[model samples]
Every structure is written in structure tokens, then in C-alpha cells.
Target: MPAASPQPRRPRAGSRRDEAARLAVLHAADDLLVEHGFGALTVEAIARRAGVAKQTIYRWWPSKVEILLDTLIEDSDKRLPVPTERPTAESIRGYLGDFARFLTDDPAGKVLLALIAEAQHDPHTAKSFHTRYLGPRRDQERDMLARAIDAGEVSPRLGLDATIDALVGPIVYCALTGSSIPRDLADTLAEGLLRPRSN
Candidate 1:
């Protein structure tokens, strides 16, 4: 059996140096992942790159994977936020477009893809990836779809997960395959999925 994942260490509050070190570690992890791929990422290498002791990183994160997860979560929160407002097809289209760009163009997206690829081979990483990242994002998407359904803006024929797959699958496929995502792919997806089906 794979060993249990390490528990994260929480740093004390109110230290500016602590916060700075945390940012440095996150940045260093991202840079290393982009430069050398996940296979080459290590706590020692990250410590050298960030100019901080390895123990400092361990004080805040459990492992190199967790450090990368931190970088992904921070960037995803900023770049892929689901708006906390009423549903509109136009607004959803905007979000879809932004999301497509984020996945295809953002460094954070690269990090996410790397983590996902690694997760395919590591059961522990798969669990952590879902629990910390994919699960929450999917939950947010489900909530938005639920709201849209309640508002009668979208049909309830397919359940939330299927609807989400319909909405997000193509963009993700393009990202994974290195295909060029069209500028209007989001508009097409949103309109197609939101269009009323003939009875």
C-alpha cells in the first residue's frame, strides 16, 4: 500500500517573513515544474531555488506536491472564479471564454495539467488532486448549474454532472491534446448547451 500522505504543517499567524517565504516556495515550485517537469521537482531543489531552508517549506506544506497544489489553488482562485450571482447565458459565456483562455494560456493551467498527469500514476496524488482541487471546482460548477436550472435558464434533462461534462469537456480536451482552442469556442459551447431543445 502507498504510504499515508504527510499532514501539512501550519505556520503561526502574523509573521511577514513567513508569508514571504510561503510565496517564495510557491513560486519556486511553479518555476521548477515548468522548467523541469514534475519528475524533477524535489523539496531540496525547491529550497535551493527559493533560497529558504527545506524545513521552512515543510513548516507550511507537507510535500512538493502540496506546494504545487498551493500554487494552483491560489492562481485558480484568481483566474477561474465562478461568479456568485444570478445566472445568465451571456455571463456564463464570458466565464467559459475566460476559462478556456486560462487553461490554454495561463501558467497555473500548466501546473494543473502537470498535477493531473502525475495523478494518473499515483493513487495518493489522485486522491489529493480531487480532494483539494478538482472536487471543489466541480462542486462550484454544479452549484452554478443548479442555479441555472432553478431559474429555468437551462434544461434539467441531464443531471448536474452530465451537464457540466457537456459544458466543460471540449475545452479540457483541447487543453490536454495541445489543440488550438478557438477564440469563440466558449461562445459556441455556451450557446449550444443553453439552446432549448425541440420537443
Candidate 2:
């Protein structure tokens, strides 16, 4: 579990000081989520943990979920390296390979599981997760599938929604089951998607 670094009380606007404070808040939130779980986390607690004001958190984010969403996005930038320069199949394979890595011992992996649990019973969290995170990624991949269709790499009639699920479903299964994803699964999936299917 990562501890939040202490930050200055009033950082100058647009300064490295200011950015440090912002990162402190994010780090504090992640630490709290890890140490206490989301149920025990609060804006007041986050402020105390970050050494900032509650208003400081509110000035930028509307809710704790938004804070977690930002932290998750940051984690994705560091972990998920999709090689878009490659063909769609390769990019998607790269993505799944990275996705599998995150599900394994990462702090963000706990966040993913917590968010999944929250989404099941909480409609608002589900909507926020979809709108702020999941939906955009799904749409991006859907666009990739559309391009693959145009290039005749995928069947023109393939339903992108199902195709996206087919590609992602295994990763989700790993996330849920806490199983280690095989290294070759990405290549297997890419081959299954791009290969000519025999009836």
C-alpha cells in the first residue's frame, strides 16, 4: 500500500507546487481506498490524509468516484500500451496483454475489483464508471473494429458490440476469477478474430 506524500498547504497556482498538491490528493485517495476500502473513505478523511482542505478536493472533483476514476486513468496510461501503429489485431493484442498484467498484483487491480462490485449494486456508480471510463474505451475499440471491417481484416457484417465483448470478455474473466492470464492468449485472440473462419 502506497502512502500519501505530505504536501504544502497553499501551493501557488499553475506551479509545480500546485501539481504536487493535486497528485497528493490523488495519492491520498488511492491510499485510503487501499487501506480502508471505499466504504470507509470520505472527502474529510481524504483531505486529512492528503494534508489539504476538503474544499480543495471539491473544487476539482465532484465525487470520490471521480477521484478514483482519475487515478485509474493515470494507471492505464502507465500500464496499457496499445501499439496503434501496428495493425488493429496487434494493437488489440497488445492491449489485452497489458490488461492481463494489471489484473495481477497491482493496486489498481483492487480498484478495478472494487469498482466492479460497486457497479453491480449501485446504479449511479455504474453510470459514472461507464460514462467516465468504460464507455470511452469500448467506443475506441469499436472504432478500431469498424476500421478493421473497412480494411477487410474483419468480416464486414461483424457486430462490433459482440466483437468487443469477445475480445474483452476473457480479460474480464481473469479480473473476476483472479486467475493469471496466459501470455499466448492475446495472440490466440488476435488470430481467432483476424483469421478466416470455417463453417
Candidate 3:
């Protein structure tokens, strides 16, 4: 038998270089996502834009949608904090306002809207968005609200679940709907949910 073809020499250095190149590709895809919408994004375009081989992209992400979701998460992760400050009503207001500003600010808002729209048509993206992005946010806010309730600053029966929905729903709706959340909405929402129902 012909001597087993010399086992292909795997270029370890090339593998390391490829890893760096793959990261660059993901970054390029992220930039494209922010500039163009996800619907318009293409793997070929991303590879070209990143100055990497198309095979490099396929070597990592299984699909353009996966790449897009990864990019969105990476980008958002850099901007959003988990709100670990002491849970007071004032803290809640401040945190929520910061979050709202993030969602409404110039380019960030547009990217968020695009992600939401894309999530509507892509179940996997939607699931990931909720589990990774929206779910944690809601959980954070809920914990803050619960703390406020414990501190006697909010209604004991404010219905934590509903309160969370009320607080987050408007902001998300406005962001996705291309509308404003109103200057007073955050305060008003907090007050409405925090005020105790009289017996």
C-alpha cells in the first residue's frame, strides 16, 4: 500500500491566525449589522467586508442568523450593565432611565429595532433574544422591584409579575414601534406600580 500519505501537517500557527481572523469577521458582521439591517446582511458580504475568506465564516457560525445574533449579543453586552446597585425606588428609576436612554439613543436604538424586527421572523433568534437579552433584563428589574417592596417603598401587592410587564412593555414597544416613551412615562410607570392599593 502506498505509504499513508504523509499526514497533512496542520499549521498550528495558521490555526491561531485563523482564530484571530474569525473574530475579525464577527466584528465586521457586527459593524455591518449596525450600519445595515439584519435582513440585508449576507455571509459573503460579511467575509468581504471583514477581509477574511468566506470559508472562515462558515467554519465558525452555522448561519448568517447565528452570526447576527452573536453580534447583537456581543454589542449589547458591552453597553448594558446588570444593575447591581442598592435596590431603592430612586435607584430603580435611575437604572430604568439609563436603560431607556440606551434604547432610544441614536444608533443604538436603530440597531435594537432591527434586532426586534428580525427576531419576529426567526424563532431561534427570538428565543435567544429573550433568554439572553430580554429575560435577564426583566429579571433584574423584577428583583429591584421586589427589593423596593420589601423596603416599604412600593405596594406589597403590586403584583411583581405584572409590575415587571408594565415597566418593560412600554419601553420595548416604543423602541420597536419607532415612537417615544414620553418624558414622564418611566416615573409614571413606577409610581403607578409602586403605589399601594387602598383597602
Candidate 4:
């Protein structure tokens, strides 16, 4: 039998080299964090280590904080999707499963945790963290919950923001507490949060 050809990679928006350069920058951030910690990882260092220009990193991200956020965001397909058609239970389970897996399996998660720790004392990074990383995902989850309300799966009385936080808080807890989220936690969150009359 002839040797089978390797499967082609999925098409991304940027040119192949463009994507490679971005990944190079992100991975360079990861490596710098590991070797020297966040205080030592600077944009210039990342650009030099990645063999890309400092301007190149700036073109895609505004700061080292965003570069780290983008690193995790890119690793997770940017963010979780709002469930429009899938059953609420299945949707939450699927989103959370992929999320936990990404955190557990990818170096991106390390950078994410580092950023979270960095954000604690730096107000500027905290703002970027919420705006770039937390805000969109929260909006997506809110949309999903709104759909669930319309479908009569979740209570109209449920506070959208807090509930969204409740569902997502555990994963964040794991990440901040120096642990990778286990996949089963996703199932638990989905089932518990969506359980009949539990809201």
C-alpha cells in the first residue's frame, strides 16, 4: 500500500507564515515566563526570542499583557461559542470540556495563570485582562443563558451576570489556585447549573 498523505491543517485567516509568526511570538512569551517569570518577560524580549520585530508583536497586541491573553485566547479558538441550537446541557458540557482540556493540555494556560497573578497588583493589566479576556466570554455565556431563558430552560429571575460568574468561577478558581481544571468539572457545572429549578 502507498504511504498515506498527512491530513492538511485547518485553514486560518492569516497567511501560513503570518500564523507561524504569531504562534512564535506567543510561544516565546510562554518560554520567557517559564525561564524568567512574568516580570522578566517583556515585549522586546518576546520579539527578539521569536525572531520577529517588536513592531510585529505590537501590530497584533497592544502590550505584553494582551500578548499573553492573546496566547490563551488563540489556544482556545478565541473564546467559547454561544449555544444557539445545541441543547443547553450539551452546549455547556461541550464548551467547558474544551475549555478545561485547553487549560490542562496547552502551555497557553500557564501564561494565562501568570497574567492573572500579574493582574492582581497591576491595575492596568487588570483592566486589560477583564476587557480582553473576561468580557467577551462573559458576554457569550450571557447570550447562551438568554437563549436558555427564552427556551424555558433557565429561570428569567436568574441574574445573568452572577449566574454566568457562578458557572465560570470554578474553572477560574482552578486556574488561579495553581491547578489545571479537570474535565469532569465541566460536566458538573453544566448539570448542576442547568438542573431543574436549581437556578
Q: Write the per-residue lDDT of candidate 2 for residues 1-199, one digit (tens) a residue.
A: 8989988689756334367778888888888888998898899998898998887788888988888888887876676633445245556667777777776667786677678778899899999999987887777667777776666555623477887687778877877776877778777876776553334
lDDT of 4 by residue, 1-199 (tens): 9999999988664424487798898889978887788888899999999999887777678888888887767765545444557346567668777666655556766677787788899999999888987787677777877777666665633477876777767987897776757768887877777664454
Quote model 4's TM-score.
0.72
Per-model TM-score, in order, reads 0.85, 0.76, 0.75, 0.72
How far is 84's C-alpha from truth in model 3 (Å)? 0.7
**Over 4 Å off in model 2, which ranges?**
1-17, 81-83, 155-158, 196-199
Segments of candidate 3 deviating more than 4 angstroms: 1-23, 106-108, 196-199
Whole-model Cα lDDT per candidate?
0.83, 0.75, 0.71, 0.75
| Candidate 2: Cα lDDT at 161 | 89
The residue pairs in collision within model 2 are none
Weakest ten-residue segment in model 1 by summed lDDT? 11-20
Where is the poorest 10-residue window by lDDT in model 3?
11-20
Candidate 3: lDDT of 54? 81
Off by over 4 Å in 4: 1-23, 34-36, 54-62, 78-84, 155-157, 180-183, 197-199
- For model 2 the TM-score comes to 0.76
Model 3, residue 31: what's the lDDT? 74
Question: Which has the greatest lDDT?
Answer: 1
What is the per-residue lDDT of model 3 for residues 1-199, given as tens digits with 9 covering 90 to 100? 7777778878665345465676777677767876777777889999999898787678677787666666556666667665566566667766667668877873444566676787888898788778867787678767877777766666734478887777767988988877887888888776766674345
